[model samples]
Target: MADLNSLLDDLAAESAELEALVAPLPPEQWARPTPAAGWTIAHQIGHLTWTDEVATLAATDARTGSTDFTELLTEAAPRIATFVDDAAALAAGAPVPELLQRWQDGRAVLAEALRAVPADAKVAWFGPPMRPGSMATARLMETWAHGQDVADALGIRREPTDRLRAVAHIGVRTRDFAYAVRELPPPADEFRVELTAPSGAQWSWGPADAAQRISGSALDFCLLVTQRRHPDDLALQATGKQAMEWLTIAQAFAGPPGTGREAGVFS
Candidate 1:
């Protein structure tokens, strides 16, 4: 298993990057629409805050927490759109400043809670119960994805950091999840996933010469999985039919298959 403490640091760094981005913005930007239809930057942060609070609960108390998540999972199975809509609508009601404060506070508590969990322990989540390292990574992935939306809404390009390598790793690790969520079985043959992280370092999964492969900059892979960038607009290349299909439906985070970013929206 990966190091939970390091993963926690990565989560904090990713979260703070978004806070820094949003903190300096004019009040008007908070209400501006993000790439997520009908959701403003405020909603982005607010949703993150809400999820962080729940994740903390799941981390510290997975027994009862998992039961609650199962109920939510059951109810949201057929109508995930309604679940998402309701969550965001409720989150959007809070004022932006307060939401940001809540996010910071929530994450602080989450960091502590995660570190206190036994390394072998699993925690409840929207998709699956995960161990400490994975739980922290999931939080990191969500913060980065929503931060992308905030960056898009502000018309700013955030410089990629080494911290983003964590998100890229999650995207690669979730290849089967991308298919599973769509009710498609994973391909029979494994595919190599090779990415150049933001630090300009190489990262990989599967065999080096799997014949079936996807290769690209880490940023593109992360954007694709987060549904923050359309494949048509990214520099990614796929060699296998399964790899190609996976790219089209990649979603690293737990959610209903997201309607990926509209082509040319972020171009």
Candidate 2:
């Protein structure tokens, strides 16, 4: 488990970075096509803001053992879908600066809620109870991944930071999340992952004696696992069938499988 203070700090920082990135875009650019087909920058940010709000409600409901979270989201999804559709429709007419400010404000509230949760406390996620630390990490990963789409569309490249460690951890731990989504049992043996961190330092996971090994730069590994970038685009080298298989379906999220942005969509 990650230290609560560190996780909170990372989430705060990631949220700020996302806000900064979106702040300067022109109104017309908000509705411009991104790498993710059928989504614009406004749509992407709206999704993040909506999910954060939902996660907070789910966490609150977990403490009370109330079904309010589930019921509310069930009823809210359609409304959110409509909002997303309407957001796209209004993007061209909306003031980009004001909309960006709204996104920043939404993220600030979400960050505050995440910081208030105890690290070890299990909160109701999409279907399972997840540690607050894990949830915070997931939020970072999603923000960074979606931010990548916006950055790509705008032809900007934000350098990776040590904060990316949180994102990488989620990517690695969710190996089981992926398996469960496929209704398969997680592999019993742990595979060794030796990744070069963005700061030029090396990070390793699992036992040294493990037969399977995944070696690559942290940025590439993060992008691959997040489905933000394809494995072929990176220099990741995986040895053994299980290691290779894991990469085939590395979903760090609980929802339905994302179609993933089309290949070379950014390039």
Candidate 3:
């Protein structure tokens, strides 16, 4: 596992990259529909900012228990929804330059709060208590996934990067997120994953001796688990019925099942 400080640095770098990608967008594009149904670029950014604030609360010992964490997400969802609605309303009449500045400001707040967390601390998250390192990893996953939405809306492409490893790690660790959404317990046995990393290297997860195997490119796996890309779009090869079953419902993000968007919409 990577050290917490290193993970924080990685998240910081990705956050900066995300800001750079969206900071200069013209106002008219804020209302452009992203691959996510009914969400525009503004909505995506709002959701990202809201999630960062929630992460900040988690890292600060603010969550009294799991109930508090759950409530936080529940409450924030509507607020973020409203934020998107309001932003889209403004986009109808507001100048593009002003909307872009607002995006920059919101992202700045999120970046500052993320940097404030202590690297060695443990914090409440959607699932198990996570160290700062894992929390930052989660943040990076969100940034990359949501940034993909923004990129797709703008019809732009971002080069694959080793940074995607953070997303893949979350996808594997949160296998239970998939199960939870289906109202099922996590599977009993571990599954092995062999994927090609962005740097043209191989990566593996789970027990080496496991009977089930899921192999593919790291980008495809990350996108698959995040529900940003479909398994069929990549060179995914699954062996063992259990591994294939898992792939049919994999989800890395915390939420109910998504609306099952088209595979590789971003690709």
| Candidate 3 C-alpha lDDT tens digits along 108-188 | 554455456565556776557776677778878888898888877777778888888888988898887788879988879
Please estimate how well model 2 matches the true structure, expressed as its whole-model Cα lDDT.
Answer: 0.75
Tens digit per residue, CA lDDT, model 2, 1-267: 467668768777877787777776666777877777778888777777666776777666655566777787576576753544454445424466766666667666766666676656677766467877777788888888888888887788998998888888888888887888788888899989899887898888888999988988888888888888766677889999989888778887666665554556554
Residue 182 lDDT, candidate 3, scale 0-100? 90
Extract clashing residue pairs from model 3: 27-96
Query: Scored by Cα lDDT, where does model 3 land?
Result: 0.73
Candidate No. with top lDDT: 1
Q: Rate the local accuracy (lDDT) of all candidates.
A: 0.83, 0.75, 0.73
For model 2 the TM-score comes to 0.87
For residues 45-86, write the lDDT of model 1, one tens digit per residue. Answer: 878987888788777685334466556567778976677667
Q: What is the lDDT of candidate 1?
A: 0.83
Worst 10 residues of 2 by lDDT: 83-92
